[model samples]
Target: MKTIEIKGSFRKELGKKNSKLIRKEGYVPCVIYDKENNLHFQVHENSFQKLVYTPEAHLVKLLIDDQEINAILQDMQFHPVTDKIIHADFMKTYDHMPIVISIPVAITGDSVGVKAGGKLIVKRRHLKVKGLAEHLPENLTVDISELKINHSIKVGDLAYDNIELLDPKVTTVVSIASSRVALKTEGEEVAEEETTEEETAEDKDKEKKS
Candidate 1:
């Protein structure tokens, strides 16, 4: 994956009051954690724009105080009213260990289905995958050059070197359906939506508890 450098300073205190103070100063309170310690820090809110706003995954070269760390963005909190990022959580990583993250999916080429008057619908924009940090790419690129009407590119159809897809094999990532010839696909999609929706709800619940 691509790497970007971010500079921050160690947070001297930790509390709701201190956090508010940090935000008032235009910095976002942040933390990096693992099984051991949680290191508190703050980085300029603007500094996170590229990392948080983009769809692609990126690794961070964190410069906090005088120490350097390599990490991946693990989670973030957004202001409910403004929809702005207020805080972030990162996880320190090593070269040899595996990390699970959601990577953006990039579809290339015009679908044959589209060319044949069928509408192509993207059901999933990203895929969750597990692999060593070095093995992960910036994004998972899928070529839809040969996708015909009513055809789909599911999680099971994808293959990558050194990467294990974490999503269910039957999950449709992208598909060319809903055309006159494929109207029946809509019924099948409803079932798939229910499955995906349940997974999303579970993830939200876990995030809230965390």
Candidate 2:
């Protein structure tokens, strides 16, 4: 996973008044939690844009005082009306310890069904996975080359090295479904349409030319 460094200062006092003061100074109140203890700190609000306002998962390198810690953003709180970040939480991570985090799903390849006029639909953009930090990938890649109309790629069908998917097996990640312009179908039982001799020859020719 990608990493981002944030510089913060340990909070001297802990209370609503102090937290409000921190926010007024353009800083966000934050905490880092681990097995042993919880450390309170404050990070400048500007330092959170790339980390909080992104779709990618990241390992946060926190620099507080003379201490440096590796952690992940666990939770965040936003102001009710302003929608500004009010508080943030981080969970300490270890290279050898297993942790669960959500990873973005990246789609690769054009679906055969889509080329055949079916509509491609993405159901889940991210998948929950568990593995060591070193084993986690920036994103989970799902190939849709052979996906057929009316068929879906579910959580159970995906596999990644050193990581386990935490979503339900039946949850659909992506699917090729029939659309107004899709080829005519006889029934739902036929997930994929049989290719005609002419179409097969055309495909072979296209492959040869490529």
Candidate 3:
């Protein structure tokens, strides 16, 4: 797993007023919960963009007042209207401890279905997995070169050597779909629509006769 450096300050005061003041100064109030105790801290809001906005799961090296702890982002709070981050919470991780996190899914190779003019649809963009920090991966890749029309890759079909997938086995991850393959399908759809309209008109005529 890749690591990101986050430098912050340890906060001694705890209250809504103090938190509000910290936020007004463009800082986010954060907490790191460990097995022993909860540590309160504050980090600049601008410094959190790379960690929060990215799709990759990154191990955090939280540097607080010259002391560092290995942690992962557990939760965060945002303003309802503005969608700005207000607070963050982190969980301390150890070398031997296994933790669950969402890992991005990378689609590799052009699908055979796509070459047949069928649109490739990805049903799932990420999956939850559990593994130790050292064994975690940046992304899980799925080869779609052999996929044909109406074929799907499900969660049950995936296997990772280092991590355990927490998603349901039956869950679909990617597939190929779309009726708009060519002009033939379009003509068939138009004929179907015309038949439906004719049936509807006949029903209306029967109702009038009744």
Candidate 4:
């Protein structure tokens, strides 16, 4: 996992008015919870976006009053109307402690099924994984080069060291289906019916001429 360093200032006042003032100053209100010490501290808001938008799960290096802590973004609140971030919460990470996080799924290689006129469908975009924060991956990659039509990649087929996927073992991650072929087959059936009707009308006209 990657780590990002963000500087945060301690907040003195609490409640809606003070939080509103913080946002008006272009800062966000945040809190950090340390399970080891059972401590929670209020922090400023601007130091959050880097952790929020990254594709990779990150361990944040939080610097407060010259003290540094390793933590993860736990939860956040957004304005219902404006969608602006309102508040955020962080959980401290400890070595050897297990944590659950969602990791992105990356599709790799050109699939044979796609080349053979099968449409590739991604069933799951991310996997929920449980493991030590340090050992957890930013994203899991699945190779689909050998996939054939009607074949699927399941969660049970994936193997990662020191990480356990929380998704059901039988759950499909990706699969190849014959969507376009089915549509073409339906079209061909309609054309054949039209052709038969035209032939029947022509035969009747020839009989009448005789």
TM-score of model number 1: 0.83
- lDDT of all predictions, in order shown? 0.90, 0.92, 0.90, 0.82
Candidate 4 overall Cα lDDT vs. reference? 0.82
2-105 in candidate 1: lDDT tens per residue? 99899999998999999999898999999999778889999999999889888789999899989999999989999999887789999998898899888999
Worst 10 residues of 3 by lDDT: 178-187
Model 4 scores a TM of: 0.76
Deviating ranges (above 4 Å) for candidate 2: 183-210
Candidate 4 stretches greater than 4 Å from native: 36-46, 181-210
Tens digits of lDDT, candidate 4, 34-58: 7545333455554666787766677
Better of 3 and 4 by TM-score: 3
Candidate achieving higher lDDT, 1 or 2:
2
- Candidate 1: C-alpha lDDT: 0.90
Number of clashing pairs per prediction, in order:
0, 0, 0, 1
**Residue-by-residue lDDT tens digits, candidate 2, 123-144:** 9999999999988888899999
lDDT of 2 at 42: 98
lDDT score, candidate 3, position 79: 94
Record all residue pairs in model 3 with backbone atoms less than 3 Å apart, i.e. clashing. none
